[model samples]
Target chain A: MITDFTPWQSLGGGALIGLAAVLLMALHGRILGATGILGGVLRFADMDDWRLKAALLVGMAMGPLVLLALTGQTPAVEIPISTLAIVLGGVVVGVGVSYGGGCTSGHGVCGNARFSRRSLVATVTFMVTAFATVYLTRHVMGV
Target chain B: MKLVSALLIAVIFGIGIALSGMMNPAKVLNFFDLAQIGAGTWDPSLAFVMGGALAITIPGYWLVFRRAAPLQAPRFQLPDTKVIDRRLILGSATFGIGWGIAGFCPGGALPALGTGEPEAFLFVAALIGGLLLARALETRGLRSKPAI
Candidate 1:
């Protein structure tokens, strides 16, 4: 039972993400799907496309710096899970996003905003699985 | 112009995720732990993040679509498919399980790189490896054919 409920901060941050997604669509007419963007960055492709993705990735990498400048301290992030868990989870997420065609940003944020039925299904599917997984781990397995 | 704008927008995205505390895996995991809700321990911050994002993005998309084309691009690069296939469900389910195990998703995890955590880097590397494996399998025609 953690006592850290940050509704306002979460909302504000989500707005920023929304604004960024909107701005990107307005400027480039592209969806702000983080996994897709990263996939593009990793996969060698057209120079023009690569430059855009790389630029976006660089900007993402500047988050801590931005927070430091704004809040006067580097953001602190905690990874309570084991390294093995993190790695295995990462691999699962990676392939899932690949086969699923998008992640939270693409399907959850942008896709839902577009009212795409497919995105909605994807979101629901993932959310249900996430809930079940958490339930199993926390309650059943007690891991 | 496009590249510069992309960079700026992504920076905003990075800041938003950070400010929202999505960068913290523990907080995210807490939100996923529904059993804690009865005990008053579950964090509902992630829902607000989604709510806030949709609030802006929905209207933003509505407004943008009104324009014939974007400012810099000639046409919108939206996804073309409307088909909900086996791959989508399987992929999403696996991703969710992974997410439940580790609170980090791509959007959150990417910005986390800024925190200089070796774990973040490792997760990303593994994620890339996963993606590469999927791509290779697809290239080898290992993906099952869609059920029409």
Candidate 2:
């Protein structure tokens, strides 16, 4: 029934995420959704400017390295899925975020925070689908 | 000034994600496990992260808006679209499946580079490819409704 819980870590991490979102909104008047940030990189013509977004993306790529140097703590990531699965998953994720309008940051954080009805629906839809996919893949298909 | 702040905040965000253990794939996968759905089967710790983030952000937004303009920028950029439609659902559903399969969303995927795993890089590459593909499609007039 029950297993592991890291209330403090989750809460704190979430707090940081919140802080980032709020700070970005507060200072820059923008949302910090990663997909949007990345996607915006390509549509420079329609956008007002791309410097800030590009900076954020660069900072994102380098931030973890900075964190590692500071805390000497390594990120814990394990991917045992097949190459095909990962590739397909990555492609779909790319398309999905593009189609859906945002990913975790956009929909789950800023979008919902703004009380955007579309965001709320999008968040619920994705979360539920993720849960179901996991169930089917893990429980049913045994993949 | 804006440039520095952008990088500073993003770096701070990366630290938070790392500290939060979101950079860990196993931990995230567990969060999505149906076996751990409710009380005890799995971990719901990550949900708290979302809660914690909202606590500050929503109010922060209100506070910031009180000012006529942003600190360094000329004006405020916010999302104003308000239509819920088929595309949103279908797009979200597809994104959800991808997330379930990899246990890594765009947010966490970047920090995943910290792990120094080749797979993470490959995933990022593929993700970029997908984004480019989406851009290509949209440029060809195949957009759903212009996400932003």
> Judged by lDDT, which candidate is best?
1
Docking class of 1: medium
* Best of the candidates, TM-score: 1
TM-score of candidate 1 chain A against the true chain A:
0.95
Residue ranges of candidate 1 with Cα displaced over 4 Å: A1-3, B145-148
List of clashing residue pairs for candidate 1: none
Clashes of each: 0, 7
- DockQ score for candidate 2: 0.64
lDDT of 1 by residue, B36-124 (tens): 87888788999999999999999999999999999998899998899898988998998899898888899999998988888889888
lDDT of each: 0.88, 0.79
TM-score per candidate, chains pooled = 0.96, 0.91
lDDT string for model 1 (A38-122, tens) is 9998767588888999999999989777888888986568887889989999999988998899899999999999999989999
- Show model 2 residue runs off by greater than 4 Å: A1-4, A46-48, B37-41, B140-148
